[model samples]
Target: MRENTEVVVVGGGYAGVMAADRLTQRDDVTVTLINPRPAFVHRVRLHQMVAGTHTAVVGYQEVLAEGVRLVTDTVTRIDAGGRAVELASGGAVRYDYLVYAVGSGSADPQVPGAAEFAYPIAGLEEAQRLLPVLAAASASAPVTVVGAGPTGIETAAELAEQGRRVTLVCGGVLGPYLHRRGRRSVAGRLAALRVTVLEGAEAKVTAVTRDAVRLADGRELPSAVTIWTAGFGVPDLARRSGLSTDALGRLLTDETLTSVDDDRVVAAGDSAAPSGLPLRMSCQMAMPLGARAADTVLSRLAGERPEPLNQSFGAQCLSLGRGSGVFQFGNRSDVAVWFHVAGRLGAKMKETVCKGIVKHLADEAQKPGGYSLHRMKGGAGRREALEAVRAEAPAIERIS
Candidate 1:
């Protein structure tokens, strides 16, 4: 009889959950998933959680496969040499393979007073913490949302729709990832909601005070509540565990998602930086990456070589409010094009996408190894981009 292979997946977000479920394809493999939260967090709808529209959480039982064991605990470190992970509570869990998917969280603003005063809505806890702060503030309070990314735009629009005064301080151009046409559509929506859009270099926030925010152009805006959605930062678990990582602290891996230091260890989601070229941190890439990571493990267990990553994207969707949205069409390379869907249709499409994501997870739970979106072709652009980087520094060492 073949021995049972033990696989431990750290983190319970989209990537971790998907990997754990897919790993159950082989009956001889026993999968265990470790996460800090008891339930699955719908990270894409975090802004909705802050705006009091959705709970942004689902019971793990609803999405995780029955064959997988869920451990509600935090992983403190990964002992690659011993093939075990140290838990925060106590003891350790041994594994034949480890999947590192401890995804991202709110980045340190680094600006003076920003961390102390601004509220970030990147994770479940962070979004939950902002709920009461928003509820306590007066309806007429001037809420300032820093950053022009999707999170900031969504939060600003959601709050503005609630009749609260909103000021969006874009450190750079508004909707930097969107085409000019899409940006115009978003600008129109924000204007209709009475949100004050501040862009350009002068709009950059320099400091945050209890009652106001200072800008780079020596202007001060009265802000009763400040929300920061600038950028995301992954946990330093990889670096702390003595594992090699990229500059942003993400576990660096080869094209097959295998750690350069140990073939038994793999990475996925926002915490993974494959070939030093990480994909954008979003649910768009996390689920596919999760499936790919599981495939790598299965291939190794079957004594076969694994394939490299080949993920593609379609569009970037953003909800302006409960009734308005914009879907910016992008090429396979994820670069925005001139085509877009705006207004009510865009809103419906955005809603469908959010619902589809949950459905995809639930469907994969029922049928292991059935997910195939990650297998789509069109990685030529990615290969070219990686080759360019490789040519620039031929001697750069691979890290994991």
Candidate 2:
């Protein structure tokens, strides 16, 4: 009989959970998931958590597969040569395969006093930290949300709906990824919610202080609470472990999500930079990446070459408030198109998606290998885009 294969997934986010659950297809494989938290964080609902709408946490028993062993610990470093990972608890877990799915968190704002004063809502703990701060502030206090990405927009709308005075600092264009029409819809919703929408270069935050945010135009806006959601940054685990990583610290991998340094190591979700080109860091993309990463390991175990990434995005959903949202449709390549669903319907769509994400994970746990969205027939645009970049420069020089 063949020896059992041990797989270790180093994250419990959408990607890591999906990968670990799907690996149960083979009885000869033992799966272990390591995460800092014991519960699965519903990151999509973190804004709602801050607004006292949802708890944003689910027990691992509800999502993780029965066959998988749960390890509640943080991975400090990966000893690739030893095929083991060092844990913060002063222990190690050896594995025949490792899936790097440590997802993203809010980037360092780098603005003065921003780190000291502003709250970040990218993770569970960050959102929880903001809850008490919000409760302590006066009801009439002005709240400033920095960055106009989905997170910033959702947070501002959520707070505004709760009767909190809110201002959204776009930094540049509001919803840079949204179509002009979609952007207009979002603007209308924010206007209805009484959120002060600040955009353009002049609206960029120059600095953040305890009681105010200074804009590039030298205007200081009173802000009792400041929330930063500008961008995301991955953990430095890859770089610290001597693994090849992109400029953003994402694990550098080949088309098959296999690490260039070791065949036994694969990557998924926001932390994966496959072919130096990565999909947008979102829950929509993470689940597919996780499934594909598991497929890569399964293919190798079967002595077959794994297929390259072929997933495609359909839409970007943003919850404006409890009753308002905008579902911006996108082509297979993920670029926002002209079509969108707005208002109540959009809110319903967003809610369905949020619940569907958890359901997908739970369903996959019940039936391993049943989730096949990652293998859909698409990604031609992704391939063409990669080829165009290759034509202009060498692959090594085209990291974006």
Candidate 3:
């Protein structure tokens, strides 16, 4: 690469922002960040925004740190072999280190009319667009949310609590991660809110019109707003660039979050699929991935051995409605157990976590370079392993 210490970060979400902020600590490094939107969207608040309890559109102009360049353009192509990035506006960016965190996009199912009719709540823009649809419908109008994952559950709970008719169509179990108690609590909360949940029924949303949802079972459910919060699929950047990836299109990375076949490139956030474990697509993994990526990058620059990838989240906090949720405690793997929290207290914690996430970005932007060189507090044992990392060395391929 032309620039010895230049860094290019793709996307501006939690993972991208964290990477940018951490890179600023490297006094000798310059970071160039690219994303489609000018502002960073708080993805966690999307459900609240759709519930009509919050009207503000969250952003991150104030969250980015100084010395970090923010480019408001989409990345069209990544030439990994040449260490370059092509933007939609017709220009290319060259870099010595690249942190790919383009993140996952809304997964549209292959059902007949789902693509044409349903609105997903995965991004800020999507939630904003669904507001008008919810507002125009009456209180008793049926609002179906397809998918019973965290996003689906949260969206359904938030709206149902507002006295709107809400239905959650989950093809599988209510929550595959929840323990018996947590599952029961969630079910109770939904029932108390008068929400109808459909489980085990194949929800093939054949069509989405303004007034109804046609299913593959030859049933048409009356719906004013059909919100789909099903699954996540990463952007096609990694696979298109001829990189190693899983079947889900997620870039396959080694233990230390580096691209399996290219040490020059590191993957983070939902877009990164690490070997040995199933990583959940959430801010929980994204934050640590960013910090670890920064450490790996600085370790190479510092001429130290690099660390392998390792992360664990022993808990899951899900907001049931405004000021209410369930905090399912678990081990490193997300097998939620009996110990949990409920009601307003749990909701407050969720809110605090989201706010803290935003404030963290702002802090990183304000203090770049001054601390980017420092390694994270943990992982001291891996210092020697990081020493072998050369700036341009190829990665050891490991697929999930």
Pairs that collide in candidate 1 are: none
- The candidate that wins on lDDT is 2
- Give all candidates' CA lDDT scores: 0.92, 0.94, 0.78
lDDT of 2 by residue, 1-400 (tens): 9789999999999999999999999999999999999999999999999999999999999889999999999999999999999999998999999999999999988899999999999999999899999999998999999999999999999999999999999999999899999999999999999999999999999999999999999999999999999999999999999999999999998888888888889999999998888899999999999999999888888777788778878999999999999999998898999999999999999999999999999999999999998987764788898798789875642111
lDDT of 2: 0.94
| Model 3 TM-score (2 dp) | 0.88
Task: Report lDDT (Cα) of residue 300, candidate 1.
Answer: 90
Off by over 4 Å in 3: 1-4, 55-59, 202-210, 214-219, 276-278, 367-400
Q: What is the C-alpha RMSD of each candidate to the true structure, in Å?
A: 1.7, 2.2, 5.3
What local lDDT does model 3 show for residue 355? 80
Error of 3 at 383 (Å): 19
lDDT for each residue of candidate 3 in 1-400, tens digit (9 for 90 to 100): 4335989999888888888888887667998989898877778778888887664354566877777898999888889888999888998999998999988778857765677778987887888788888888899888999888889999999999889899888767896678888888889889999998877756645667767877667677898788888888778988888888888888887777788778888888899876523378888778778877777787888778677665656567789998578877776544566888777887887777778777766777786433321243333323323334433464454322
Model 2 TM-score, 2 decimals: 0.98
Kindly indicate the candidate among 1 and 2 with the higher lDDT: 2
TM-score of each: 0.98, 0.98, 0.88
